[model samples]
Target: MLFPVLALIPATRTEPSSLLKLLAGEFAAQVAATWPEPHAAFLAAPAARRHLTCLALALGRDLPPIAERLLGGRLRHAIRLVLDPAPSGLERLLGRLGELAWDAEDYRTLLRLLAQRAPAKVLRHAQQVEPGAVRRLAGLPEPMGEAVGLALELTAEGVLVLREAYDALRLRDGPEAADVAASGWARAGSGKALFEAVRDDLTPEPLAPPHAGTTHLRPLRSKAELREAARRYRNCLGDRLSDAATGWQAFYEWEGPPGAIIGIQRDPIFGWRLEEARVGGNGAVPEAAREAIVSELALMGVHVGRSGWRLERLLRDDVGRGYRYWPPSQDVAEAFGDED
Candidate 1:
């Protein structure tokens, strides 16, 4: 157990080279003493060879001749382990590598490690610190393009847009626009021209005249309608709501009223539900009634916020729920009589 655990620590140290050598010797002694022959054989086995090679590399010393001899028949397994280690082991190896002077192979190895692990910050640092090395590694004849491309694709939508533009304008009508668009497209693709064209065309058409019999409805129309529409729209998003809901819930949970239950109320005309929570500052409704209201609103896909407040206010005043009064205490019924 101790040998396995101690094997994890990289042999490189902050001390002088001599001290590292001493430390490595001590570690080796511990392994020899504490680990049985079977355990040593297992470590030297084809399946475990890479871990051992990594251990030797990290130690900055050649493995014992005996260990090397054991590895001869397990070259493939050793190669695989060196190629991929446990996360902790990989991290340790990287940290050890960082101490060495730059080498092309070392840079390539680091690039491969980053591509596999998606260590974005480390990769960025590596790119910045050794740009030429990164470029060389990128140009290497390897499947590294897949990893590099994936990273770019994940974070560079702007680059994609540029590529699309270049593709779109590769051939076009007018020489001037075509020239400009073609240059831009070469930078990305012809899609850029098409994108620009679509954007220009999509500029809002003059509002069509309302039909003679049609009564004008405002874009969102009323606050109630807006709130309901937002709610319904959000519900259609389903699991997509998890992120939005989490953010909203966290905000309201801390800043909004205590004991406030959120809810929704649908607009009868638009079939949209107004959703919101009942807070203490507002007139008191029974806990059950508030919950019921909020639940109905949520089921109708309403979330509580500014729009919710507007809807709630509208419901209370326009629907006559606002003027309705409840006794604060059942025991003192007359004390709160006629309260709005």
Candidate 2:
């Protein structure tokens, strides 16, 4: 019964009256709803309900009883910021944090990060990672703050992967974490560069669903493996370890003379598409090797870019790549014939 309209004004503290009105409406609706047993546990708990307001109650209902015990009187301010406005782009994250091991002080740090307006990606990832890990980084006022303030320099690609990679680097390099953090935050530093610099040293997380690699196309499973491949190919494959680490892109090396690397990335539109096939030192991929690579990848249900158009009479399938009206290449065969 709450928020019959999907899009309402965002509940920022811009105007006291407007925020209060919205709060009142939400409260009335929620109070009227029937929450039984554990869902209404907060309402029945020893803690006062003064701080739980607006959509927070909706989030509150889903929290496991342990959260109720740990966060006695009030939900953290950061939790409030993330829970309100209904479509915070973080509703999914809220649902998954029912098991958060809350410390009053830790919650305060989270609040500080939000009040200072950390990037949405950073906040989202913070919620996803271990709270203790966040506490560690939050304590590093020098580099992480520099990392946060100079976001434009480092770019989101670097910050997006910061927490996970930071944790990994801490585990692997230990005392060197400070230097590593500086590498990302110094005026000359960047997130991408930081990742590239320590890609081999950083540990690799297990790929979800665990891909079984072929003899010729073994998936890049470790950062050490990435370093070896990058050296052999003389390509920037090392820079793409984050992509492979996340399983968004799977990097596989061809075991042979004139060695090659194939990048298969998951595409929302096309399941899995062959994004790259590069030879050693970024040389042009030979047609014979290209054919063999494509053939083997196809057997694994992976397709190349816009790759599924059936070969028609007298049309070479490999030469064309584009949508109906767009041109994938300047080749005459692609312009006049089906390319996608």
Task: Highest lDDT: give the candidate number.
Answer: 2
Q: Write the per-residue lDDT of candidate 1 for residues 1-340, one digit (tens) a residue.
A: 8999999986643332332223233343423332333334434334234334434454444445435442565444444444444333333343333322343344445545455443434454442333333443343222223334333332245444434443444333434554453333233223344344433322222222111111111222222332344354343222222223222211111012233322222333324333333334433444444444444344434432334334455556435554543322331221112142
Candidate 2 TM-score, C-alpha based: 0.37
Q: What tens-digit string does per-residue lDDT give for candidate 2 at 262-303?
A: 777776656776767777776666656666676777777776
Clashes of 1: 25
Candidate 1 Cα deviation (angstroms), residue 70 = 14
Which TM-score value belongs to model 1? 0.21
RMSD of 2: 17.6
Prediction-by-prediction clash tally: 25, 1
- C-alpha RMSD in Å of predicted model 1 compared with the true structure: 18.6
Please, what is the TM-score per model? Answer: 0.21, 0.37
